[model samples]
Target: MNPLEIGSMVKARYKTGAYIGRIKEERGKFYLVEVLAVLKHPQQGDLHNPKETEGVFFHERRALAHHEKANIPKSAVSAFTDDIPDYPASLRTALQQLREDLNGQPASAYRDLALSNMDSLEKDYFG
Candidate 1:
């Protein structure tokens, strides 16, 4: 499928809930995104290691695109969605493996990191 078509919904690897956004293209790839939101993180309150907190506090319209593996930032992500049918055993297995890999990490960690990185990229590229 042409990835950059408008009205297409894609799931970001980190952002939960199906990201119902349109696809945008840059140089030569597609990104799926929705209205941007301000994300906040709670302060850890550690003296030795100051805690960091952030969250989606503001809403802004934005677009996302997919980049080639080599061109993608260390932070760039692959699209995800729940539309996959139940018959794809191999794909399901791979997803299961990924779940296993993330099983032990704190749930908030993924959102915190992905949102932060996405914010930085947005500012750098679109600002």
Candidate 2:
């Protein structure tokens, strides 16, 4: 793969979320990216524990704000050629998708916990 140039738009996985952003700088094995839109909302609940609800801290993970910068590993970044969606619209879509995916599953504590966290996140996002 060709090395990505600085200022190029990219699709990147940063932690538990995916984002569309522009590469700001390349540092060793990482690229500094400026978030333009969210492709997926960050997963809630303890990262290490994943879907567990018992004996673990449930958490809220917000999508990166527009223009927010994060250092993402090179392997997680790829060129994004499509038109960038508006941050608000993209975030709402991602959140709705996650909620729907959870809703599709048979009811479980993990699903319930994730849905509950999404509810709070939605409230905070819009209000």
Q: After superposing candidate 1 on the true structure, give the runs of residues whose Cα lies further than 4 Å from its correct spot.
A: 1-4, 14-20, 30-32, 35-127
Query: How far does residue 10 in candidate 1 sit from its true spot (Å)?
Result: 0.4
Question: On a 0 to 100 scale, what is the lDDT of residue 79 in model 1?
Answer: 39
- Across 1-127, the per-residue lDDT of candidate 2 in tens digits comes to 6779999999999989999999999999999999999999898889999988899988887889989999999999999999999999999999999999899989999999899989999999998
Backbone clash count, each prediction separately:
19, 0
**Which portions of model 2 miss their true places by more than 4 Å?**
none
TM-score of decoy 1: 0.23
- The sequence of per-residue lDDT tens digits that candidate 1 reaches over residues 1-127 is 4433443434333222122222343334434344221111122122233223334332222222223111222133333354532222323333334344445446665535444544554465446
**Native-referenced Cα lDDT, model 1:** 0.33
Give the candidate number with the greatest TM-score: 2
What is candidate 2's CA lDDT for residue 93? 97
